[model samples]
Target: MKPIFDEPEQYQSAVAKTAEALISKFGKLADGKAWEAARMPNLTRSERAYCEAVAVRVTRLVRGGSVPA
Candidate 1:
């Protein structure tokens, strides 16, 4: 397990992998900036849609309090 922000390398790698997988499964991403774009406070409709589709996994990721490290 890895803390998304505390562990920068792992976080970016995870995001890249997730983005690639998302692209492969769902046509194409509206805003293809997987790294920088994700840091934004507000995501576009397409990004929101993609996140909402996968939000259920957040619980699995959370261990006790944080996202595992």
Candidate 2:
């Protein structure tokens, strides 16, 4: 079995891919509450957190808010 915290690259890749897909589907009107309502059952808590962060960043950017560096 894979060790916890041993696959950062894979984790980031998965998050990025999922984020892109979510962005494409939701576009500029993406809503965190709506996304949470439709959360994927297969993702772990950490994965969900990362995806939610991406969604928040996207939403902020779309609304002309600056994302923190």
Candidate 3:
């Protein structure tokens, strides 16, 4: 199916919105579970990639390192 976000700006906006929602829901301590939850089947490849990046950034900011063991 065709993705909703065709333009780069639209994609970025969607990614930022997803990240903000995840951060708000999971708080500063967003873990691997949060990242997993963000992975919806409907997301396009680029959206998933951006979400992964946000997850990593959030994890680093919260734990000051990679995700916990």
What would the per-residue lDDT of candidate 2 be over residues 1-69, giving only the tens digit for each residue?
894347877755655565556667777655564367447788888667776766666666557777554
lDDT of each: 0.45, 0.62, 0.64
CA-only RMSD, every prediction: 13.2, 4.3, 6.3
Assess candidate 1 and give its TM-score to the true structure: 0.39
Task: Pull out the clashing pairs in model 3.
Answer: none
What RMSD does model 3 have? 6.3
Q: How far in Å is the alpha carbon of 26 misplaced in model 1?
A: 0.7
Regions of model 2 farther than 4 Å from truth: 3-5, 31-44, 47-50, 53-69
Q: What is the lDDT of residue 7 in candidate 3?
A: 67
* lDDT for model 1: 0.45
Q: Which candidate has the top score in lDDT? A: 3
